[model samples]
Every structure is written in structure tokens, then in C-alpha cells.
Target: METEPSAALMSAIVTEHFVLQSGAGTTVSEALGRSSLYLSALSSSLIALGFAAQTPGLLLPFAAAALPTVFVLGVFTMVRLVGTGVQNMLYLSGISRIRGYYRTLDPEAARYFARWGAGDGETDDALGSLAVRGGPMAGLFTAASMIAVINGVLAGVGLALLTYYVVTDHHLPAALAVGLVAMTAGLAMFFRYQHRCYLRVQR
Candidate 1:
């Protein structure tokens, strides 16, 4: 049987992990929001221009050709958003774990984590809120939710355009359905990617 680790070693490990968690959480969450904004802008521009590119007489073939490009770009953008989301989740998991250790060390400190107050009004804005209920982390997640919604809208538009093209040019109903599924997979991708992150934070 292996010997038990010393209390000092355990404490050192916890402190190191806590610092790592704080750094990663802050960095990745900001990166996720920034990237999401960039992709949202990119997709919006593409959508607007794709429609503008339509000619009065050549609408059908032009839009049909644009459908594939739109769908591919939409899927690619959404994949990056989902990947960034997963990294954010990892950061949240670290934060959750560190918060647990803090509470374990001193249950009374939980109140301070929610709000640090030394009777100074300045501390109100300076201290970060650790309350999982509608705190800064909540805002991070809300941003993610909004990003996902925008991505879903883009995917839906892609599906409609692709479906129109498939019906007009391919003459196949089954192909249209498959195209819908493939184009609208953004939400599916988000849920699948974030599921593990949710579980990690929960634990």
C-alpha cells in the first residue's frame, strides 16, 4: 500500500490549482466572448451581402450557388463558437472546484465571496462577485447563450436557402430534409459540447 500524502503537500496542491483555475477562467471567458462577437459580425456581413448579390433576373442560380458557401461558412463559424464555449466550461469547472475548497476552509467566508464589504463603498465595485446565482459567471453564460442564439439564426437561414436550392435544382425531397439536418446542426453541436462542461462544474 502507498503512504498517504502529507497535509502540507495537499494544501500546496490546492493553492496551485486555485491560482490556475482563476487565471484560466478569466482568460478563456473573455476570449470566448470576443471571438463570438467577431464571428457574429462576420456571418451578418456574409448574409447581407449574399442577398445583395442576387440579380433581378439571375436570382435562382445565384442564390443556389451562394447556399453552399453560406452553409459552409456558417457551419465553420459555429464550430469555432462551440469550441470556444467548451474552453470556457473548463474554466468554470476550475472556478467551481476552487470555490468549494474555499468554503471547506471556512464556511463563514462564503458570504465574503458573494460580496466583500469592509464598510467601504469602493469595495462594492472592486471586489468580484463569486455568487453562482446571477453573478459575473452568470453574465458570462448569458453572453454564451446569446451567441448560440445568433448562430442558430444564421444556421436556420442557411437551411432555408439550401432547401430552396435543393428543391429547385435537385428535385429531391429526401435530399432537402438531409440538407436541413446538416445545416441546422449548430444547436446540436452546442449542447453536445457544453454538456461535459456543465457536468464538470456541477461536480
Candidate 2:
């Protein structure tokens, strides 16, 4: 014969479910806040760069200083966003587990919750459905990927400016080629980091 859970046990589980939901919400807010902050700073930097460009012979120097700083900030923001994303996933899993428990207590309630109370695999699929069925490319729509792309462009443009002025004596073609390569490399690195983070989470 199966014994029923005590009132205290049931209350604790409900409280835990609420807490996990709150935590997931917090992670999402934090991700948005961080991304907004990075973008605002980038915008301010661009404005400053524009003002600098208006001055005689100030554009390159100003860009050389500002672009790297923005790129670094973007890198940090991207990493933190990835961390929050993982945390959010863990919180959602916890909430799903609680819903699963509820279904166990009253099997008919499972229908109300849809695939959420089905099983872990089904829950994962349901959660991931928002990202669509595409593979890695689908993941690029995330905040972290947005930051990665911006940072890559910053790095490439900054390097191209330096190369054109210092190495190639204002050779536009060579500089563009170098910039493209740098941008591609930076994006690859950012994507690799994202992959590693998710891989660790899965483990």
C-alpha cells in the first residue's frame, strides 16, 4: 500500500516550485539587464567616436582605444548571459519536476500540464521547442550570440584600422581582408565557448 505525503512535505514542495519559478524569472531579467547595459555602453562609445572623428586626426586614435574596450565588455557580458541562460534552464527543470510530481499525485492533472508532466525527455523537448527544430544556427538567436557577433565586428574593424594605418600604409583591400579573417575567427571562438558552456550544463 502506498502512503500519502504529509502536509508539511507537500507544502515544502509547493514552496520549492514557487522559488524555482522566481529564480528562473530573475535569471531572465538579469540577462536582459546585462545585455541592455552592454548595448547602451556601446552606443555611448560610438557617439564619442563620432565626436572624435569630427576633430582633425582623432578618429583612428579614439577608435583604437575605444573598440578594444567595447569588445572586452561584450565578451564579459556574453559569458555572463550564457551562465544566466544555463541557470534559467536548471530552474525550469526544477519547476517541471514539481509539475511532474503533481501529476503523480493526480494523474489526470497531467493532461492539463501537456508535455510538461510527461517525462524529462519530453519536458526538454517542450522547453527547446521555442528555439525551433534547427540545430546550432537556431541557438544563434540568443542574447549571447548577439553579443558575440557585435564583439567580433568590433574586433575586426579595430584591427583593420590598425593594419591599414600601420602595416599596409592605408591599403584598403588588404585591410578589409584582414578584418574579415579577424571577424570570422572571433565569431568562431565565441561560438566555441557557447558550445562548451552548454556541453558542461548537459553533463
Candidate 3:
């Protein structure tokens, strides 16, 4: 007679799977939130800077403006790339491949999945849910990243244009310098708050 899986073995398998799923879900959620905040701050800063650029007779600090915008654009691009990579890892199913993918997935997801086999759903449905969550999060990250890049480049162009006028004794105005300084302070505060939130979550 063929031997069947013992009750203990089946339970253990289900438990392991449940734990993994829970962990993954939580991780995706956290990453989504972080990316959202980063995007929001970038958007607001860009908008404020753009407005300051439009007013006639405002001083624009080309180098200072370009520096932070470039840095933020690069960071945003990197975040999107990482987000896409994470989503891809989540969808693959080969044994070794799955192991690698799990490394990128939320640690809590793996543990949660380990603990619950189907979690009250068909096998296919359970897997589908995880994919659904991952895909949307990746898309949101990509959209925000792209917008940030565009805004940064545009802001740089504006600053550069303004600089030519200022240098030729168009009588450099104080607005550019003051605006950049203010924006920097705002960004610092935004990041500080974000860091605090992350720590709270960790705790």
C-alpha cells in the first residue's frame, strides 16, 4: 500500500507556508508606504521650486538647485528599479529560483505562508493574491519614480536658464538662493519624519 503523509507532516507543511505568505504581505505593504512618502515629498518640492522659477525678477541658483534635484532623481530611479526586481522575484516558482525570490520578499510573508497552507482558499487563488499585491505596488513605485525624474530634470533646466540672466548683471536677485535654502530645510524635515515613522514601525 502506498504510504500517506502523516497528520503531523501535513500540519507542519501548512504552517510553514502560512508564515511565509503573511511575512511577504507585510513587507510589500511597508515598501509601498515608504515609496509613496518619498514620491510625495519629491512632488511637493518640485512644485514649489517650479513656482518660484516662474516669477519674473527672481534670483535662481543654478548649481545649488541642480545638485539636490539630480541626487533625488537618481535615488527615485534606483527605488523603482529595485521595486520591479522585487516584483519579478515574487512571481517565479522554480525551487532554487523561488528560494532566491523569497530573499527579496518580505520575511514575514514567508513565515506567514509557512504557517498557513491555503489560508482558506484554493491553492491557485492563494498564489494569485500574492501576485496581485506585488504587481500594483511595483506599478505605483514606477509611476512615482518616472514623475520625479522628469520634474528634477525640468527643475534643473529652469535653474540653468535663470542663472544666465542673473550672471549678466540682470542684477542677481535673492529669491533663488532663499528658495533653495527653504526647500532644503523642508526636505530635511520630511526625511526626518519618514525615518521616525520607519523606526516606529520596526519597533
Candidate 4:
């Protein structure tokens, strides 16, 4: 017989899904910010390089670019390290909290909660077991971070070339600027849409 889930079952499923999605959203937002910063730094360095290369100095141009590049990469690495670390801990802690919550309810109700809670627990367990037997969250966050990194690299290179041309009194390149603007707008729209989807699911 086809049976409807109990109220407790519904609650458990919703809670688990909410937690996972919230975590994912946070991860995506963070990656977006980091990617934007990385790209901006790279763009600045390229602009500085173009300007410094015009001077009669020996080390200025290279130093200008190298210093910023080093700073960007360093920041990127540190952010990834910290963010992934927190995500890992949060995943485990959230699951633990969920399991504990289910422990106190009536047995029949608790059974439904237990089933969904098990799903929640398994989500964390699978991630935790990925590497170091506790690094799935870390790895997932790292992978997500790379998506932004890759986008930043492309955006940075494009903006740098555009800036170089602009400062040199060359006709401002319309195409690159247009492309960057389009990409930024698209990312914003995508995030907004995803957030709306999250809300609809929650409601």
C-alpha cells in the first residue's frame, strides 16, 4: 500500500535538505567573492605592468606584476584552506545536532525522523569518508573553489589586456568590456535564480 509520510518524516526531510542547500549556497557565494577578488587583483597587476614598462626603471614592471600575482595566489590559498576547514566541521556538527534532535521525540515519530536523519548522516559520512576519512566537505569546498578560480583566471587575463590597451591611449576595446559585463551580470542572475529556487522549495 502506498503510504504518505508522517508529519515527523516531512519535518526531517525538510530539515536535512535545508541544511545541505544552505551549506551549498554559502559555499557558492564565498567562491564568487573570492573569484572576483582574485580577478580584480590580476587585472590591477596587468594595468600596473603596462604603465611600469614605459618607465626607464629595470625592476619596476616585473615587480609590479609579480608582487600582485603572489598576493592574489596567497590570499586564494588561505581562503580556500579556511573555508573548506569550516565546511567540514559544520557538516559533521550539523548532522550530529540533527541526530540528537531526533533522539528525544516519540518512538513512532522518531522512526520517521530517524529515517531522514539517517539520510542526513549518510550525506556527511559519504563526504567525510572521501579523503582522510573526514575530508569530503573539504574536498567538495576545494572543488567548488576551483570553479571560481578558473573563472577568475579567465576574467583577470581579459581585463588585464583591456586595461593595458586603455591606458596606452589605444581605442578602448569595446568587445572585452562588453564580455566582462555580460559575464558578471549573468553570474548575478544565476545566483538570484538559484536563491529563488531554494525559497520555493522551502515554502
- In order of appearance, the predictions have TM-scores of 0.49, 0.90, 0.42, 0.39
6-41: candidate 3 lDDT, tens digit per residue: 789657655655666565566556556656666666
TM-score of 4: 0.39
Better of 3 and 4 by TM-score: 3
lDDT order of candidates, top first:
2, 1, 4, 3
Between candidates 1 and 2, name the one with more favorable lDDT. Answer: 2
Report the C-alpha displacement of residue 67, candidate 3, in angstroms. 6.0
Q: In candidate 2, residue 39 scores what lDDT?
A: 95
**Candidate 1: regions farther than 4 A off:** 1-18, 25-51, 57-144, 169-189, 200-203
Which lDDT tens digits does candidate 2 get at residues 1-203? Answer: 76788999999999998998899889989999999999998999999998998998998888888888888899899999989877876787677677767777765877775553223553363355344332456457778999888888888888898899999999999999999999999899888888777656545
lDDT, candidates in the order shown: 0.53, 0.80, 0.46, 0.51
Report the C-alpha displacement of residue 128, candidate 2, in angstroms: 3.7
Please give the distance, in angstroms, between residue 132's alpha carbon in candidate 3 and its true position after superposition.
10
Candidate 1 local lDDT, residue 131? 30
* Candidate 1 residue-wise lDDT, 35-150, digit = tens: 56656665666676667667564555654565456545545554555455445545544544455555555559677544332322222212223333422344335344555556
The superposed Cα distance between candidate 2 and the true structure at residue 101, in angstroms, equals 1.3
